[model samples]
Target: MMREILINLPIESHEVPNLRELVGWDGRHSDYPTLFERCNFWAGLRVEKNNELIAFGYVAGMGLQHGYMEDIIVHPQYQKKGIGQSLVKKLLQESERVGLEIVTLTYDSKHASFYNESGFKPCSGGLWRKKD
Candidate 1:
């Protein structure tokens, strides 16, 4: 079943550290609060039974022509259960609902097939890159 999703909410006490530990990053990332506050769109997937945040992702942009997906994190315990794909699909939908002309993301190629199934293509298809 699909879990509950919380949208556009402020980061909580546990979230950034949760993500940091999941990905093995060290140090307190002081910049994340400001960054999370500035996201054009973001969401957290909550476990239905207990409302625990198990996954999250965000898109940052100027809210005009494009959005860039970043910081997609799924707790290690929840990996491979389709949670990551679901969060990403939600971000994609938000970008579209806001009338973005395009959306882009970079991911480890180990997960290339997942992104392909989620409606992304290679940058060579001429849809993404930094402006000249």
Candidate 2:
């Protein structure tokens, strides 16, 4: 039997390590803290079994019209279990709740099918990275 998954917001800072592990990110990095500080809305999903954090995602809004989904990840063990879809759906709902007219997320081409199934469509965009 599969364990129930619970999704909630206002996640505690102590859970960052688990999230880093889930996404293979460096726990020592301050990116997670910055995300919590900067994101307009965020959510995390936990497995009820051991109360382990198995998924996380966040959204940031530019005014009330555009929302960007960021840092979506699910533990490899939890992939293909609908956890990712649930996370995306939760972010979309939050975006709608805030009156966002457009929602966007960036993902690798290999993951296009997943986002496409979740109602995302192909669109052209550009990115510019500032040099350190």
CA lDDT scores, all candidates in order: 0.77, 0.76
Q: Give a tens-digit lDDT track for model 2, residues 1-132.
A: 334333345566767656676577766455656667777877777676677667778788664798888778788887898888988888887778779889888989999999999999999999889999
**How accurate locally is residue 49 in candidate 1, as Cα lDDT from 0 to 100?**
77
CA RMSD per model (angstroms): 4.4, 2.5
True lDDT of residue 95, candidate 2:
77
Candidate No. with top lDDT: 1
- How many backbone overlaps does candidate 2 show? 0
lDDT of 1 by residue, 14-66 (tens): 67666767767652566567777687978887766766667878889899998
lDDT of 1: 0.77
Best by TM-score: 2
